[model samples]
Target: MFCYQCEQTDRTNGQPGCASAKGNCGKDATTADLQDLLVHALKGIGQYAALARGLGESDREADRFILFGLFTTLTNVNFDAARFTAFLREAATTRNRVKARCDELAQARGTTIQPLSDAAAWQPGASLPELLAQASTVGIQEGLKKLGEDVIGLRALVLYGLKGVAAYAHHARVLGYESEEVYAGVETTLDFLARHPTDVNALLSHALELGQLNLKVMELLDAANTGRFGIPQPTSVRMTPVAGKAILVSGHDLGDLHALLEATKGTGVQVYTHGEMLPAHGYPTLKAYEHLAGNYGGAWQEQHSDFAKFPGPILMTSNCIIEPLPLYRQRIFTTGPVGWPGVRHLADHDFTTLIQAAKALPGFRETASDESITVGFGHDAVLGVAGKVVDAVKAGKIRHFFLIGGCDGAAPGRNYYTEFAQQAPDDTVVMTLGCNKYRFNRHQFGDIEGIPRLLDLGQCNDSYSAIRIATALATAFGCGVNDLPLSLVISWFEQKAAAVLLTLLALGIRNIRLGPTLPAFLTPNALDILVKQFGIQPLGDARTDLAMALAPRAA
Candidate 1:
């Protein structure tokens, strides 16, 4: 498949990508090629749409499609080759329709314009076989030898960051938030890429610009989440399953989870959050559901064992879906942009069939022992106690703040995050977010003064919360964010985490630690640029890194 998009990419000495028949993420070559064609189709649209905008014509429909289409191609989001083919054909139609409109406007103005560009002029094949042939010229590795691996890597970085932006924007749109700026940003970057500039500096700038756009989208999503459901507050969630009919919902979409909660209310189908949805309990509106039981599993990587062990049906609401075992494959369902070849998908926010299936299956037969973990320490919650936090730091009760968080996975190197959290000095506060926290979120780190040493700050997308807290702490301490006694030890596994890393680098945040192993897509040259520009470093010994972070700032 030749895919190096996620953290689990093959890292052999000669080839640092999955170039075999199947990708490390289980994506087959046919599906990977189709996805490449879909993106190429999107770039074609951008090529024409950018020209169309110059003629005082714009396409809002094309803009929205660009976001939604790229979102479907993100890692572990969609694996159906049929869907990729449909999107490719649909993108061609969307581009041509927009071009036709622009032409009409030009004709009405009594103006003759130059002929359509090569990208806009090209047409897709009429049938599946023809489309398959067309995909060969536009694959991700189309010009790797000519352009050099560094340029290809930089392009992939910008494109993948854009994918992350689309995923977050899609979530916000589902909750009734939309922005023309985000659309413009996506179109502009795609248009830039279509023109084929190979300047390393220019490509790096594009990456950081995508990072800035990602920040805006993250803010929109944050508003959508906190506004729809009240701001997240500190709450203890039950880790043990409750006795009743149960349905486990995983992924990052709060709106989908909310719909499922509303649909199953009073029907005696007890709903439980899993994976990324574990943070739902902190929201006042979601917590109001009496049947919304505790979380059932650990991170997304453990889904095979976790989902199989659960007695009831399982619903995947977003990214990071593993192939379910035969024991529970039929019982697993998908919604939103997430999909699988055979899994039943729920659309229109309706969960009637799913609820029925839940009732039909054997649920938790008896209550498990009581166990709970604290969550919901979102931006508002942390800032709510900013005064106490500041006072503790000034009094030397809290020596440092460790922002150890990111996407969690099943790799052996992932244990480093757990160890890092466990070994943080007793005087430091170990704050976390995303599924990675599942490693040690249950561990007792004790509190510094009145603040809990382990503070869970929602999901992967909640990096906004961490940013807000860091900025506020910097403001409170009368120093820059880097000058504060805080360190960001990010554990990345996918594109969303990649986008967040770019955001930090774009903001000039320095000395950040990223692990378990760098992205395989990062060529040595591109990696050098990041390490030099941002003072970024790969993870080393936790104890050693901890000492460096604890060292006093230069006067």
Candidate 2:
């Protein structure tokens, strides 16, 4: 039941992970075991799926199942052990379907199927205890004694990176975007894991390759979102509540938020974006709905207090859901890959139940004073004023750029990001995305000339925007991205940040600072490899890091 997949995982007694009855994220040992088993089952599906794809046979359903299944195992995404049990059974069924298809294709091609690993042939147990027993054999620690920490750590890196990729890919997939290459990449990586190769270099190489795959997935997602909702534009969103029946939409699914917005159009229910959904306000199509109020609360880590205080039904469209407090437990609903054992789940984007609950609950009885935040400074919006930005840089009006954001958590060390952003020199501009920006977004950074000093590039899902802006700026400057006067100060809480980090590394970006803590799964040897190869650094004092980033040598 040991798990250290997120930044918030307990390290009491110098333990490597949360091995107690309940993890720091509130996921119990049983749920953790079930998630591990589900991953093992997905590896089986991947083995068969990869084989099938190689044989000129493809199962789209099986491929999608792999993505969604892996996404569910991400930190704080799904904590329902029963849901994982069902997923295990479904994984076996999906694997069998792909296996049958592969066999048929091989027979038709007059080619014999190759022998497979235990994951490819394994079956799930009928009961929870039996499944837990099976899971024990496949846990991440299973090979530690023989393979050692370095190999296991690298494997964990690949696996966690894949989970992040799957989460992003799944979001794009829901909006009718599909990439066969991305699917193949995922299946191939999973198949690689199934074989349990111990070569450190090979594992590291595969992880970088996963990062490239994630870049592709992120591109597809960007297209899916922008194509559906139009490119995000600079828009001001209200931070204060308006009087009405309200439904607070959280997580990162724009499609779900759109559906709920459409459903409650004339029902007097105001849909407020929460957490990662805060960026939705910048999308033209989503914002077109007058009833789509504005963002509520802050990041995922504050949901307990935020949700309890919010006077409306809350819908979590994706990951970063916590154990719901009783105050709002009945009013909180889940969709997509997010789950809590007793929480009501809305499937197929049906918002009727959610809308009804919003009506029944007491929404904001009176309007709060008007306050707002600016968002939608995505690549399109920012690059639209490329001339001014480049001119400012050349004129020395803007001295540096800081990309400070990632998944935020309640860790006290997270205060470093807030201070880092706050302490940034007046001549420097800060561009942020993900929920982490909540720390300093409210602060008045003003702007360099006409360009805002703090640019909100939307959700972690909008990481592609950050990459795009960086590459574009690099192009304009006639230099490599790293050579540009920009620094990435990231605070990661979960797997999505892992994927984003891999993408940055794969792109040969270096000297990025990552905190609040290094991943527990990364042995010192593995950390050393990353530092030596990519110049990845553990974050230090915000002021010191900022000074270093601005030093003449850095440029």
Candidate 3:
């Protein structure tokens, strides 16, 4: 059909008539159409939020819709067709409200607008095959361009970051902690994004603004996490499978990690973190569980190979799910939006399936005993050593802080992240999360003042740690976040990475370098805007880039 969400596209590859085989990322015809509809609905809901704002409407429904819709669009989060259709129905309803409000705004302003007045336009009917056909006929390339890929891409980026935030927000909300301002940003930004036209300059401004909002979101989450679970501290998690049956938990879900830890309290099964889930070990509450074992695998992309080798059940809590190999397919259980048709899914955070599956799967034999790796360097933990850090800085013992973190992928060029982390000077500190951290987490980068140069800060979702550390450093230096001598060299693989990058941008943290390649989804115009307005740059060679990053800026 007609869909071009990834950087690789048939239209751009000299295959104008051929609708398939353009993107190397493995999404097919149906997946593409579903994604488009989801995006369209998200935009519609965003438009509605803007309308409600004009009327000074304070509706929680609008906020939830924006948050859920955006979260659903994130990569590897939601793959179930039935769930997507349900979301489409809800979004259509929200879209109508947005269009109606948009029309009202136009009328009040004495300007004519194309009123997306028909609520029924988005309503689904029995013509399922026909609709799919229609979508196929709809020029995918043309529609994406019309939608302003750059603007749409960037907005999607912001929404994705919020999704990561929402993941944390959801946990905090359940724990009786909520950030009203974050809720407001999630609503207002989505609404604004839905109706607003894509202007490079405007998006550049909004991108940074999004960062500012995300800073607040991260703060709210940090407070929630620390307040509920106690401040994070340095923790060393093992990397080997434990004796008896075990369940491997992946993604960024502390509550689930805690739940699993609680459920397995007396059970013989052990638990380990995989991918982004590795950071759960840093939390004081969760780490205290004796059954919580060490990390099993690397980032999400390696699942095809990594999951296959595991001797027990594996739980996928969120994104970065690759098609499971047949060997380990039965042992794989997914929760949250991560789903595959035949795999067991635990709805509503229910661990019945997880616990049962852990028991049923052939119990794992202890491969490594009591071995561990250090984790849990949130702002608090880092700050605990802030005096030493500052002293090191003053003594020229710690020269730089390289935040080498983001999503991991199978792309050949992806090795750059590992190379970059490896090449980082011994006097520097490497803060990382997400799968990208896997590149150099195991590498021996030497140490500065008893601290390893490469410090694992949990998962990609733990990018919050990087943000917190930056803000704290800035506070200590009595300057803004940008004024700190911190450099963020990020690698992006999916929408979540996109969102994290936007959060960085939203915070006005500029002069950052991103790679292996910019999202194919972004148009040149959008790229230009980011480069000129935000001073954002793409990555060069690791050594060269490191030199540029470490070089003192002009006064």
Candidate 4:
């Protein structure tokens, strides 16, 4: 099996990807192969679903299944080969249902459907070995001999961007926010990929179009979250644990956390947020629970130590799950698209077993001293002070703005973000989102004219908030977003971050710095296209990059 979907992929012997028995993320060969086949199956569904939609017959189930199936194949989301095997069969069934509907629609209209691609008609194998054999033909390198590395890399870029869009759309979907436009965009993009187009310009166009689709999905998600939980407000959250029987919920799913909070309402179980769930505390409805305790850990990369030490059961609601160690394996549960072969998974928002496990475990023995940090500087909170912010800029009190954040990983070179945020001049305000903010959030940056220097804008799922805030600032100053005194320093580890990057490029935002490392899937030519088109640059020394961002030309 070969996979290079994430930043941490093995790069042995000048190779660009992991081709060994296990990847750097701990996904074994078998699971990686299964994920490949699952993607192939989803493309088959897309081929039929796209045609059906054109015939004026759309299957909502097929649309939702396509989004969810692609999400499961994202980096570190699902590693259970058996789960993916089942998903393959489900994909076939879902495709067949859509195919039949398409046929019926054509019959009613007396028009013949166009000839379909192989992906639309391919059959799944009956057993695991047969599936593995089939996977070999559809893997990432399948087009290398015919399409060359550059075209293949561009395809990977489009596919990975779609994976990010699917993940975000799925999160909003679970909260009952549905968009027909989003469904159509996803279906057509997958269908385009199924055709195996090799033109570099076409692939780049599709990538930017996917970016626009991602922007819409982000907006829908923002609405879903704010509609359900109300707009996030500035609130300080405890970083230390409180003494009680406790349950820790991680990932970016606020819906799951709300369910657990309601379930444990009167049970003496204290619920704590972890990873990206830290921003849930800013929501009025979620924070209203008296027993809803504060956050328990840092980023997802540190979960091994964090989960092991937390004296309670843990729940992962989405991506960035690693192989669980024995110490906390029994108490950790997974939901939604995340899976590990032996880990217990909670389905349909049921937390009975999870709550029971929390009750049996020893929670924090004594209350720790109050240690806290403030969150909830989303668009609403930030823009509410737009008048003051603009005034400060005119008065020459605020010099620049830095949007420094993205997914964090355990890989080397990530320390650049920490040092960069730490060394940022006091005159600049740093706005951050995603788990990467954990790098320097605890540091006291003070404030300028009563506005906090560091603003935490929810999870990676809340990137829309960052975009909204930036656009608002530009509007207030009577300039384009690129003219605003803001610089984006993003650290990406997986697909969702890829989608966010595409959104930025689609909006014509330029001169953004991205690292710890560039994605291995991008060939040099492909990377050059991004560089020339979007002015994307790799991160350099923290001091040098900061100085460059603050240069007079940049201003």
Candidate 5:
């Protein structure tokens, strides 16, 4: 197995599923085997949901379990060997219960079928090659139209979207909010993927369903965010690391950032935001912490180099972790679902260890001589200026709105985003979210009537903010959302971006230019359906794309 689709691949042009026989990071054969088993177990859990549906027993716990389990398997989230094994055991138990119930139903109907739960019963000592051979014969990868690949790819994208939903739902759960529909979507999607073969129409329907489900998930998260932290206000966050002690927290979890800020309070330890944490500066409750220092790095993909320059400890509260560089390895810690085998792991919302580590690390040395870039243009802030924005548009002061935001990574062509931002028309306003915003965060695009060229709207999860702003803009203008003079040029690198994209589609927004190469997981047919149905086009050259985006739309 060989995999290297992420930014921190040890080897260039590596595989996505597995990077070498035993992942390049010395994951070893045993770990690889367990990871596969864990995936299969989760698949089993999803299959069980169908049985539950049959018995009319759908509930919150089952829904949460499926979403959380799939999200945990996503890259860079969970790497703790022991914790994963325990999760697999739990999955096995759930699988057994599902099988038992199915068997009882079958017996009552005077029908007999093999129990899906018993992994050993299916095939005794069957070689992997034999299973692969049989599966290959019936698999959806061989055809003139490549229908199998297309269907598989569509399902894969939907599964990835579910993973993103789980991540956000889990975050909301941590913040004391839960959505039953989001969880049900997870179970339903899983059941569909586990049992069905590649079918073009079926996959297309699922993709759209994914879009619909993600919209609800984002709304649930948006409610949780605004309820906990007051609506975001426009504010500038310092780009320089503070002098003396500090802890740089990176991840999409605002709750975790708040908790860490609280834990480090009065400890003389300055708190610095990194990656997704940059948005914390915009939140009323979070920014109130005077000790919260400026942002420490550029983006998630740069952690290998950027983290090395950090003068203090770094706590990763979520995804986008690429194996830490040696210089920062000792000072790096992970909490929540994120983990590195030997790295210090904090469990069960316990950030005390993180606080202690920050104290033990070398004090943060002042790095910034002056202010660099300003962030924090969340939904509320944008809405506050909605009238001015509408007037500017009507008055021909702002020509276009470019939402050049999504995930960022070390992919070669990703520089296209920076070039695009640099080349966007002077009369345009750029809105960004997630680490993708880093590309042009410092790029001077000048200003339009006191508003900066680029507006940062927080993290990947805050894509909801952008959606809200878009909808509000449409409402203010009394026109359909797609009728607004706004365009989205998004770059996706992970599951969270997938969820956000689905939400945009659910809202019936169209003509989105997405790039840095389409996901390797997307099949050709699925791509075609997207183009035909939603007018989703891939980005070309920076100049060409920018020109096309700024040009007048067809009547």
Candidate 6:
């Protein structure tokens, strides 16, 4: 098996991918191959489903399936091959379901409609062996002879970017947000790939278009989250756990967290947010839970150690779930797109089993001493204090603004983000989003004019807050966003971050400093295109980058 979708992908021996029995992320070959096949099958489904949409026939369930199915294939999300095998059958069934609807619609309208022969009519074997055999024809390497590595690289970029779109869209979707435009974009892009276009420029253009599409998805998600949970407010959350039967909810799904919270109410099971769920504490509807305790851990990468030590059951709601250790594997439960082979899987928003396990175990024996972290400074919160921020900037009390955002990973180079934030001058305000803020967010930076020097903007999905704040700041100064003192120092570890980057680029934002490392799928030529066209730069010395960003611009 070969896979290279995340920032931690192996590049050893002059190779660009993980081609071994196990991926660098601990994904076994069986799981990795099945993920690739799942991707292949999704595209096959898209080929037909996209045609149906074009004929004015669309299935909401099929569109939603595309979102969840592709999200499971993302790096560090799902490792259960059984899940992918099931997804393959689901993809085939959904494709046929949409295909039939489109056919009936076209016949009534007397419009001749044709579907792609390969994806529409393709069939994979029912058993594991047959599915494995079918996977051989549907991998990226299968087209290397005809498409070449360069074209394949661009295709992978588009596919990975699309995966990010799906993830954000799914998060919004679960909260009752739906967009026909976004759904059409997903299927339309997948169908484009099915047609096998090899032009380098076309592929790159298509990729940026997906980036444009991601912007829409992110906006919808921002609205869904705020509309339901209420705009995140500036709230300090306790890092120490309280004594009780506790349930730790991780991953990016607020919907799942809300469900678990409601189910565990009055059960003597206290809920604590972990990883990406930490910001949920700032939402009034979620934090209103009498037993909803504070956060219990840091980034998603630290789950193994964190989960082992926590004396309660854990529930993972979405991405970046590493392989669970045996110590807490039995107590760990996955729901809604997260799965591990041996870990118990919960579905249909059920948390009874998890709550039961939590009650059976000892929670925090004693409440730890109080220590807290501030989060939930989403756009509304920040913009609420906008007048003060603008005044401080005008008076030169605030030197510049640094927007450090994106997913956090375990890579050594990620420390650059820590040092970058640490070194920002006292006169400058540093705004951070996503889990990457964990690296240095705990560092104490006092406020200027009643505004904390370091502002936390919720999760990676809350990037809309950052964008809105930037646009508002630019408007206040009567200048373009790029003309402002803001600079984006982003650390990308997954496809969701990639989608955010494309959104920034498509908006004509320039000079984004991206790291811990470049995508393995971006060939030298593709990288050059981004560097030249978008003014994108690789992360250099954090100190040097900081100095460069703070330098004066010419009139």
lDDT of 3 by residue, 169-221 (tens): 55455455676577766665655555544665666566566667766666666
| Candidate 1 per-residue C-alpha lDDT over 164-269 given as tens digits, one digit per residue, 9 for 90 to 100 | 8888888888898888778777778787877777898999998998889889989999999998998998999999987889999998999998998899988998
lDDT of 3: 0.68
**Per-prediction TM-score to the true structure, in the order listed:** 0.97, 0.99, 0.86, 0.99, 0.88, 0.98
Better of 5 and 6 by TM-score: 6
Residue 134 error, candidate 2, Å: 0.2
lDDT of 4 by residue, 179-296 (tens): 9899999989989999988889999999999999999999999999999999999999999998999999988899999999999999999999999999999999999999988999
Candidate 4: residue pairs that collide: none
Across 58-140, the per-residue lDDT of candidate 6 in tens digits comes to 78888899999989988888999888888888888887787778779888889887647475676768799888887777776
Per-candidate alpha-carbon RMSD to the true structure: 1.5, 1.0, 4.2, 0.9, 4.2, 1.2
lDDT of 5 at 271: 88
**Winner by lDDT:** 4
Which sections of candidate 4 miss by over 4 Å? none
Q: Model 2 scores what on Cα lDDT?
A: 0.91
lDDT tens string, model 2, 275-300? 89998999999999999888889888
- In model 2, the worst 10-residue window by lDDT is 8-17
- Cα lDDT of model 5 overall? 0.73
The Cα local distance difference test for each model comes to 0.86, 0.91, 0.68, 0.92, 0.73, 0.88
lDDT of 5 by residue, 1-555 (tens): 323222233434432344455654445434444554555556666666666666555545555666667666666676666665666666666666666776677677777754554331222114444433333332223322355455556666776777787788887777878865676677667667666546778766777788788877777888888889877777878887657887888877888888888888899999888887888788888889999877888887778877887777888887767677789888888887777777888777687776787778787665558575777798888888888888889899899998988888776788998898888888989898888888878877888887777888888887788988998998998999899888889988767777778877877889998877777666567788788989999878889888787778789
Poorly placed runs, candidate 5 (over 4 Å): 2-19, 22-33, 50-61, 97-147, 365-367
Candidate 3: C-alpha RMSD to true structure equals 4.2
Candidate 6 — number of clashing residue pairs? 0
User: Which regions of candidate 3 deviate over 4 angstroms?
Assistant: 1-26, 49-62, 90-121, 130-140, 144-177, 196-198, 478-483, 552-555
